[model samples]
Target: MLAALRGIAAPPDLPLIQRRNFLRVQIDAIGVGLASAAAPFLPIFLTRLGATSQEVSYLTSMPALTGLLLGIAIGQLLQKQRNIVRWFSAARFLVLLAYAVTALLIEVVPSAWLIRAILLLWALVTLPQTVVAVSFNVVMNGVAGPQHRYDLMSRRWSILGITMAITTAVAGQLLEHLPFPLNYQIVFSLLSLGSLISFAFSSKIELPPQPISNASRTNSVFTRLSHLLGQIWREKPFVRFVSIRFIFLIGTTLAAPLFPLYYVREVKASDAWIGIFNTAQTAVLLVGYFAWTMISRARGSRFTLLVTTFGVSLYPILVAHTHQVQVIALIAGVAGFFQAGIDLVFFDELMKTIPDGQSAIFVAVAQTLTHLSSFIAPIASAWLSDLYSLPIALTLSGIIRFLGFGLFLTLGRKDS
Candidate 1:
C-alpha cells in the first residue's frame, strides 16, 4: 500500500505543492476511512437499541433536513471565505465528535432515551455536517484543480477504501466478541481518533487564494440568494445534470435506511455477517476506483455514468430477491464496483457544469437538491416498509433508480 501511494505521488512533473497536497489528501483519506468504518454500524446500533423504522429513517432524513435548510447558506458563506480548508477541517472534526459523544452517552443515557439522545446529537451535528458537505468539494477541487481531479480522487478513494475495509472487518469482530453497548462504544471511540488525524493533515492542504467576489456583500441576503439561483438557472447543463442526478439520488437515498433493516430484521444477519457485508463492498472499491478511472479516461464520463448508473440500479432489486446473507455480500461487491464509477463520474460531470470561480455556490445548489431528495426518500421508504415490507420498498427503490438510469441513457450527452 505504501509503495502504491508512493508511486501515485511520484509524478516527477507535478509541482512540489501539488505533490505535497496529494500526500496530505491521501493521509486524510485514511482518517476518513477509519471514521467511516463506523457508518454501516450506526443504524445497526440504532436498530439494536430498539429504534423504529421511522426513527431509523431519521438517521438519514434528519441530516438531509438540516442540509436542505442550510446547504445554500453555508455554500454562500464558504464562497466568501478566503480559506475553505479551515472550515472543512473544523466541520469534519465536529462531525466526528458526535461519534465520541454517542460512545459516552451509551454509558449514562437510559436505554429508552438513548435513541432520542443520539438523534438529537446528530441533529445538532447536521449544522457542521452541512458545512463539511458544502466545503469539502470546494477544498478538494481547489487542491486537485481541474486537471488532477480524477487522479487525486482515485488515489484518495483507493486508500480510503482499503483502510475502511480493514478497519470495518476488525470492528465487526469487536462487535461479535464484546458485550453489546460496550463493543459499540469502543468502536465509536476508536474510530473517532481518526478525526484528530484528519484535522491535522487536512489543515495543512495548501490551495491558491480564492478570488472572492464583493458584489454580493452589498446586497440583501435574499437578493444575493436570488442572484445565485439565477446564475445556476442559466447554466443549462448544470440544471439538466442536477435535475437528472436528483432523480437518481432519490433511488439512492430511498434505499439507505432499508439495507440495515433488511440485513438485521429481514435476514437476521449477525454482527459478524454485517461487517463482512460492508468489508466486501468496500474492499472491492480499490479495484473499482482503478477500473473506473481507466474507463472514464478511455470512454468518457458520459459512457461511464450511464454504465455505472444502470449497473448500480440493479443492486437493491437483487438484494430484495436474495435471502442468503452470503449472496447479498457478493451482490454488494458487484454493486460497489459500479458505485465507484458513479462516484467518480458524478463528481467529474458536476464539476464540468459549474462556471469557473463558482464551485462553492454551485456545489451547494447541487447538495441542496440532494438533501431535498434525501429528506423525502428515506421517510417514504420507511413508510413503505412499515405498510408493506422491506422487499417491496426496496423493489420500488430499484424501479426509481432504473427510471433515473433510463433518463440518463436518453438525455445525458455532451451536446444535450
Candidate 2:
C-alpha cells in the first residue's frame, strides 16, 4: 500500500502557513469517510431486516428534517462557543450509537412498523453529527485561509473518498460471508470502531482560540434574516452564487430519494452490488476531487463549478437509461465523480464572493434551501415515480437540473 501510494503523483505543495493544518484535514477526512461508508449500506440493512418501500422513504426524509432543525440550532450555538472540536468529536461518538441501535434491534424487530420507528429514532440520534459538520467547515476555512480554501477542502474530500472506497470494499467482502442480522450488526460494530479513530485523531489537533464576546444574544429568525438579506444584497457575487446553490440543490434533492429505490426495485440490485456501486462511486469521487483541486487552484472556482455542474446534469439521463445492474452501478459511480467536482469548489467559491462576516449566514441559507428542498422533493419524486415510471422521474430531474445550470450562467448578467 505504501509503495502504491508513493507511485501516485503528489499534490501541489502548500505554503508553510497552510501546511501545518494538513494533519487536522486528514483526521476530518477520515471521519467523513467512516461516516459516509456507513450511509449507503443503511437502507440495504434495513430492507434485509424487513423495511418496506414507504418505510425506507420515511427513514430517508426524516433525517433531512431533523438535520435541518439541529443544524440551524448548532450553527447559532457555535456563534457563542469558544471551543468546537470537543463538541464535534462528542457528536460523532454519539451518532454511532444510532447504528448500534439498528444493529441491536434488527434481529428482535422484524416488523416494518417497528423498524420504521427505529429509523425515526435513529434520525433523532444522528442529528448532532450533522451539526458537527458545520464546525468542521468553520475550522477548515480558518486553517486553510481564503486563498487555499478550495484546494484544501477538495483534497480533504479526495482523502475521504479514497478511505470510504477501500473500507467499503473490505466491509462488503466481510459482509458477504455473514448472514442477515449478524451481517448488519457486524457492520455497525465496525462503523463504531471507525468512529473511535475519528475521536482519537481529533483530540490530537490544536484549535485556534475564539475571540471573547460580551454581548447579549438575539434569537429571532426574522431578525437574523433581515440582517442577512441586507448583507447579501450588498454582495452581488455572493447573491448570484447562493441562488445557483439553491437552484441546483432543488433539482438534486428532487431526484435523490428515488435513486436508491430505483436501483433496488427498478434495476433489481442486490446488497453486494449496491456496496460495489457505492465503492465505485467513491473511487471516482476520490479521483475527480483531487483532479478538480489541482485544476481549480489555477483556473478559478467559478469556471470549475460551471464545468462540473454541466457534468452532473448528464447524470440523470445516464441513470434513467441504465437497465442492467452493472450499467446502473457504473452510471452511479460516474455521477459521484461529477458531483465531487461540483461539491469541492462550489461553496468555497461562493465564500470567495462574500464578506467574511456573512459567510456563516450565506452557508446557512444555502444549507436551509438544500434541507427545505429535501423535505419537499422526495414526496414529489415518490408521487411521480408512483404515477409514471422511475425512468421518467429521473429524466425529468435531469431536465430541471440543466435548467438550474442555465440559471446559474445567467447570474452575473443584467440584460439577459
Candidate 3:
C-alpha cells in the first residue's frame, strides 16, 4: 500500500489529490483484474457444472438483465448521496461474496433450474459492481476532467490490462495444472481475494461533497429524471450522440450473448484453453492499450476512436472464418487490439455528451442502455443462431458496425 502511494506520489504533473486518485484507480484495477480473470473461464465453469449451450447463453445475459433494472436505481441513489466511495466499497464486497458462493456451491447445485437460480443469484451479487462502474466513471470524469479523461482512462486501463493479463495468465497455468472442479475452485478463490483487495482499496478513497439542493433533494427523483429527459431532448448534439451510442450498442451487443457458447460448444475448447485464449487476447489488448495511450494523447480521442472502430468492425468477420486454434488466437488478438482503442474513444466521447454537474445521470443512462442491450442479446442471438447460424449473427454484428461507421461519418463528424 505504501509502495502504491509512493509510486503515485512520484508522478510529475499530478497534485496530491490527483496522486491519491491515481492510487485509487490502480486499486480499482484489482476489481478489473478479477472480472477479466473470470471472463475466459466462466462459460467453461458453467459447462463443468452441467450447463448446456442455451443455459450458458442465458447465464451470459444475467448480469445485464440484473443491471438493466438496478442501474437506474443506483444512479438515482448516487444523485442523492455523495458518499460514492462507500457505494463502491459495498459493491465490491457483494461481488466478492458472490464469487465465493459461485465457487463453493457450483458443484453441488442440482438441475438446470438450480443452475438458472445460481446464475440469477450471481447476477444479483454483481449488480452493485455495475453500480460501482457508473459511480467510478462519473467520479473519475469529474476528477480527471475532459482533457485528461482520455489519458487517465487509457493509462488506467493499460495498468489494469497488465495486471489482469498477468493474473489471467497465472490462473490459466493453474487451471492447466489443477484438476477439474478444484481448478475452478482455485480460480474463484483467487477472484475472491482480488475482490477483497479491491474493497479495502475502495474504503480508503475520500468522498467528495454532494451538490444536490434541499428542494431538489426533497422532490421526487422521477421529477428530476423527467427534467433530465427534457434537457436531453433540448440538447440536439447530446441527443444525437447518445442516440448514435444506443444504436452502436444495439448492433455491438447482437452477438455478444452467443460468444461464450460459440467457443464452448462450437469450438469445443477446454477451460484451460479458454484461459490461454483470453491471455493471448489480453496480451494483445495490453499492447493496444499502451499504444493507444500514446496515440490518444497525440491524436485526440475522436481520431483514436474512429480508427479503432474501423479496426473493431473487422473482428466478427475474422471470428466467423477461423477454424484452427492458432488462427482463433490471432483473430482474438486482432480484436483485442482494436477494442482497447474503441473503449478509450467511447468513454472519451461519451464524457463530452454529459451535462455539467449531471455526469452520474448520463453515465448511468449509458450503463443502463448497455445492460438492457446485453439482456436482450442472448434471446435474440440464440434465435438467430438457431434459425440461421453463428456466422449469420457475426454478419449482422458487422453490419451494425458499418451502420455505426455511417453515423460517425455523418452525425458524429463534427463532434470528432
- Residue pairs with clashing backbones, model 2: none
Q: Mark the regions of model 1 whose C-alpha exceeds 4 Å error after superposition.
A: 1-6
lDDT of 2 by residue, 106-191 (tens): 65775655576677677677577566656666666766677767656677778888899987877777777788667877887677
What's the C-alpha lDDT at position 383 in model 2? 80
Indicate which candidate wins on lDDT. 1
The TM-scores of all predictions, comma-separated, are 0.98, 0.87, 0.91
| Two-way TM-score contest, 1 vs 2, winner | 1
How many collisions per candidate? 0, 0, 0
Q: Summarize candidate 3's per-residue lDDT along 1-416 as a digit string, tens digits.
A: 79655474235476677667767767777676775576657666776677765677766577777778888777877877767667767776777666667776656676555577667776666677687767877766755766677556766776677777778778877887898778877787667677777777667766466576565567686897787678667767667766676766666777676566667667776555666667777777667876887897887666786788777777776777665667777777888888898887787778877777777766777788778877786667777887888777877877788788677767545676
Q: Quick one: ranking by TM-score, best first?
A: 1, 3, 2
Pick by TM-score: which candidate is best? 1
lDDT score, candidate 1: 0.90
Candidate 1 residue-wise lDDT, 137-254, digit = tens? 8888887788878888888888899999999999999999999989999999999899988889999999887788988678998889788878888999999898999999999999
